[model samples]
Target: MDQPITRRDFLNGIAIGATAAAASGPLLAASMPDPAARALPGASPLPPAAQDAFGYYPPLLTGLRGSHPGSFEDAHALRDSHTWPTATDTGQEYDLIIVGGGISGLAAAHFYRAQAKTESRILILDNHDDFGGHAKRNEFNLDGHLNILNGGTLEIDSPRPYGPIAANLLTTLGVDVPKLIKTTQNLEFYQSLGLQSGVFFDRETFGADKLSVGLERGPLKELLAQAPLSAAARAAIVQIQEGNIDYLPGLSSDEKKQRLSRMSYEAFLRDVVHVEPAVLNFYYARTMGEWGVGTDAVSALDCWGIGLPGFQGMNLAKGSIRRMGFTPAGYEDTGGSFRLHFPDGNATIARLLVRNLIPSAVPGSSAEDVVTARVNYAQLDRDAAPVRVRLNSIAIRARHIGDPKSADQVEVTYLRGGQAFTTRARGVVLAGYNMMIPYLCPELPAAQKDALHKLVKTPLVYTSVALRNRQAFDTLKVHRVYAPGSFHTYFHLNPHVHVGRYESPKSVNDPILVHMVRTPCKRGLPEHEQNRAGRAELLATSFETFERNIREQLGRTLAAGGFDPARDITAITVNRWPHGYAPEYNPLFDPDVPEAERPHVVGRARFGRIAIANSDSGGAAYTDTAIDQGHRAVVELLQG
Candidate 1:
């Protein structure tokens, strides 16, 4: 069973809690470590803050001077530096050593701490001073008003959106989770193309045009009953919900097999509840934007797993909603989409996890106790097999370098700090992008990388802009805009946390921070081939190019919306994750059966140690997938 947060831990928890509460609104910020302070014996100064965090300029950088940026190589150097404590010195061995400090690594650590029976010593190495890779938070003072901005993974389907996870993670770590996932009254849908109108028969806006309807609160049954529909339509919808037919409208030849493998959602929509084509299109757009796949892309059997069913009448579990930081004016507004979040988005959870991993890191304890408990990275001598984890490191090259039988294990060399180093492990986890996987494991026959490369890739550029006035655009009902000509999507995010400008009683002139996200670059096709021996391969491009695309698109949006692009801007920052997200199912794979059971080697493990766990590994990039894989990997080690 998971241990409860002890009383002694409450002191430190309270400090972080107060900090989180203070930064509860939007503009939840995090302190950026100095880039110059990162220098080791021979290592060069690390990149500047802007390079590391997309040039997010909040006041956290004050007096924080460091230049050494942490990378995979740093872990190896820390291991050799004789700093901190380690199991190797105590003659102890661990089952695993997770390299990355992102969700994958943290989840693995959480699982191992809870389940593994092998007396495992979990060591997670991240070059950054803190954890929570992409899911991070930022806070700022826009014209004297405090606000928070989510740097990554802003919205999530947390078991409780505003309770334990959000509150504890943020307050405990001084992160503003509540501000990121801001609570809101309702969602407003806007037409992207002034599409043909439709109708809804039931709920608060009964017997109204779909384009003009706005749904208010009601139970699932009540809401469905409110929608105006013929008896035939209702029955057909019921059948679809009851798992009797396929309702997804569009399906390609290959998609038919995948959809029919289970119940089809299309059958229900056509034969049962009988939603009109226009209504279906609206539903399709919203669902696609949210799930990253068209409605037909999923089986009807899987539909209930997403948002609440429209027919079910807004079925919210009891006592799940909290009213903290919600404004009467925002809630009374006609159109808006809102939720609450912690300061660093998911990084809040990551920080909480790392605190637990450190030895004796209880609340109010001296920094020395925390330091003493830390498992030092240095103590890992090649001869010292007892060392469980070696962080701040990377395996530069791994290969079947010599004769097959005698040299069974792959030879791996890595750089640590400024020095080159070498080591060999029984197995490895290629838990990064698939693009990099082929380069490391070339022994696979048929150039598997090429096939993987053929799969369609989507590029996204996320931007966060904190404004000086929250009410400037309050008159606009729609928070999101879909610009078909320029990028995939754009939205004015309503942060989950309580931004002081939006919440403070004394503040009438607070600046609003509007975070706009879009896709600017072309990434769907495979890279052109350079050699004749093999087909053209796909090469990934830099993130800067992606950001440029977004800037260009934003300029168009300014022109279309009639906003002053130059004058309206107060403080603007851009964060680019070059490899944003991967799509599900490779273009070549059979979707009918599980990828693992199919003939191809997609999403499979080789031998035991060299396991791959990326969003692309499962061919599906999702929070749950990452968590499931992390647990699965831990289980694999435990079973071994």
Candidate 2:
């Protein structure tokens, strides 16, 4: 649906940081499980293999879980006396106080502690109980594979080199970067994640009449070429061996960087690679699921930046791990085996960081020293910052105009429990999305906010649908990529699909989850009005609606492939993300923003002491980007 309607009868109806209600009729009851126990069912279980494959590890099946801000600070107070300078003599007035405990916030915490081993008072305040903001981790115990599953920021690719900040972390963590470059391991990694997909072309040449087995080819050959492509396809499996893809036109220059920034991603692919229309659509669907932007809206610059430097037209690697038919034995790190992750994506990292920041209170302390410990998603309603954490805390502002010499010292404010609360800090790092900037800094110059708004990321809604013990495509291979108009993401999970298949148990009769992410219209009245027709039609797709769709698709595929329907189908679980995906498709580069445009915000800044940070700001909205921004924010603060 264009706008996912809030439902009352849907499974665990609208998780508002509370117990979920059951759906109207369900064959199997799936309750939220502990974070430590829920893991991604298919592809790589062990940490080593985890890095090599693409897909979320430790599936985020439910709401957030971990330490809250209040308790965390109290623990620090008791652990170090200087932390609390007030009458209580606890760690309160920190040398460095960070607001908004998202990925960037946590990464800042990690960087500060790691850089300066000397226990400098550091306090991190997040409205949410869990650290990662958009990067949420969920846990569910359904059939057998029960561990922390990732709900957002699913995977990281290698073609895009890590920025300085992320590279620094990799060095600090001592991850073997070279391993990811190799091919044998990378190919196996692709197979493990069911990335064994390809663009089916009707003709050997670039533009063909027929596509996807029987679908008629659209007349938009030029448009279709500008779609997303797999690394191998873009390089034409040729440029990698030559290593000169970066010399393409519209590249190697800063001014013209935005040259490809205006057109749709599909347009860029067609203009660059001159590939077949069918292959373009296949790759386009994968990109849509990954970036939440369709070919039409996504910018060519973003497409180029996100993809390998040049070689714009290409298909994703499939079956085997040959980028361009070359055995990238030396480029292991680019392959699947080099992926690094926590059991539950980066949420594990957030937990570790949160633990280090909080004071370690004694197990059985008295009521006086007990410092009330409350961790709930709704704590923000109680002005919970005074108490503890509110799960869904959204930050609105952070800035420091009074002290231009050091913008580090700042004021910040955020909304918790649906109410606004402000805090003061020595430094503030805004790590939220760019669109959120307008709301946080309401007084910001219209031009700046509007320009940033132009960089709005395509909005997306992800629905994780699980079908239990129903093998409709038994005859077909377990993994296969679908064409456009069909569900964007669908793959088998458990026994047959996971990495380390030999060691991991299989489930012929167990439930397998299929994750489907669709593009949703942007927020605000304009988008809603524009998408009213689609919204009405899509609103009917409840868990049952999804089940019926899958059954319909499965019936067609199975009938063609030859498989039993009734005996194979089992149960289903549907998880929805309404306000997901960043809004910017192609970002505009405005190097200099006027000072007047930067206004004091309610939650964004507090007397140059607190700042905000999230992918909501500019730059690629990834875990690494958040980390880089965190480091930049801290550096700015320390300088002041």
Candidate 3:
């Protein structure tokens, strides 16, 4: 199963967000609890030492991912209250040492090698068991064939066209997005099978557990007739979807858009369009998957930008809106970008980069062959490799060797196994969480540090379930479902993708992977606050809770189709991203500030020999942004 589909998670998951924290904020430690009380219900048992030692294969590992255990304990301890750890010098040095092994970090390494000397040794330290940051690839071997799905970043896409640097980077990696999409994706497979998009109204939220198929393709009358919505809601939905009367009739397109930019999508529907409250459920989850905030938290302009209903009559021009020193990306953001999702999503990009940077790590020479190539994790951090990627290594501190203005080298102290080791580098790139940068390098200016702290990431989960078969979905004629009230708001059978040497299941009896998405956000709070609350909720949620909800929701939604959760689920991988999507700018909650003064911009400014890079630093949750940021960070350092 694919993890919570991020907007870039391929299908463009941006949905309604609302859900209060069930437990206290994870950072504030004094809440109270014994060891047993605090233990996560389904916290995975520590794998054997050898498993992570030389046989480290994280793609095959299932269960909790995306900030898995032993990954964040040190960072948390340091964040709670800074206690710098003393380190034993490793007598090792590098030209560059990147603190993240995600896309941006890998790209930084690739760029550094290209510009610097060929023998310039670079090291990428990551806390996770595997690299690629949020672009995670999950693998499941059933009987003989392998089932693969992305646990995180899913597509080489964005709201707008990829800039030259990012676009050229993909081409250089042998990833022809258009060519790959044609060769790998089967968009008509579900259509041929007569399946369509649907909604599952649970009894708790809709008064009855019902599945309504073809909500987009089939007759709207059938859905209206079957929905347990109030009569007023039914009529309102029809008017919104099919009617043409403009709510903001008198205002010009720009004026209407300006007003929309300042309000939430929910307000546009309820107060402006005069829709009944019950109608919100039908459209709530659409925005949740993208930013983890519901219609109430999202800008009305954004709803219109994404083709949400009730906007046709307004006749707003297909463009952007600027108000109060900010530009809303709704209409302006959606444009051309090649969409390509590999068998393992953007992890193919990571593997391709790894292959380019560290020769034999991923053997294949082309992006096509990389789909089925098993990575040699053992070779990742070899001493002989000029560019080494060290996993399961948490960098506790990255500080300049001396004064702010004069330091030419940096010291990076990290915890791997149980001891602290220090490595020196000519320059360093902090490519991890933007919010955590303040803790890593405390010597930065107070305002810069403060700016970095404001980049709060939205928390979410991407769950993948390996099923015995997709009979339930096929029977119900639903390739996807939108369940607003369910724990997982959206789920679907992964589209059949045949690429390289890998092929998706072709038979109804063949095993399939179902992907589910959950963005836990609290209502009423501002966007950043909502994201913070969502992160806390995700941190407190147990895999047991996740699994139970998965079973219950699937059972209820697919019962009519004879789906049996207990018997059909062969495996489950819950990719919990407590700090999920990189915080994107939102006109509703974020302050209207000049572009250069924005948190991402101010925070990303180079500090001496240190530079920042990541999608977070760019304030856009897309692969292109990460690549762009990485290139920029590298260029800044090289120029100096």
Per-candidate RMSD vs. true structure?
Answer: 14.5, 14.0, 6.5
What is the C-alpha lDDT profile of model 1 across 540-597, one tens digit per residue?
3222332344343433333333444344445444543434444443221224444444
- TM-score for each candidate, following the candidate numbering: 0.53, 0.56, 0.92
- Candidate 1 residues lying further than 4 Å off, grouped into runs, are 1-95, 113-131, 138-146, 158-288, 291-340, 359-394, 398-412, 415-420, 423-427, 444-457, 498-508, 520-563, 586-591, 598-602
Which of 1 and 2 is ahead in TM-score? 2
Best by TM-score: 3
lDDT (tens digit, per residue) of candidate 2 on 316-404: 22222222111111122243223443323445444433433442311212211111111122211121121222233444455554754
Shift in Å, residue 375, candidate 2: 13
Question: Candidate 3 clash total?
Answer: 21
Best by lDDT: 3
Write the number of the candidate with greater TM-score, choosing between 1 and 3.
3
Q: Point out the higher-scoring one by lDDT: 1 or 2.
A: 2
- Give candidate 2's error at residue 497 in angstroms: 9.7
Pick the winner on TM-score between candidates 2 and 3.
3
Please report, as a residue range, the 10-residue window in candidate 1 with the lowest summed lDDT.
8-17
Residue-level lDDT tens digits of model 3 in 167-278: 9999999988888878888867877898877777766667777888876565576677888888788788888888898899899998998899888988888788777666
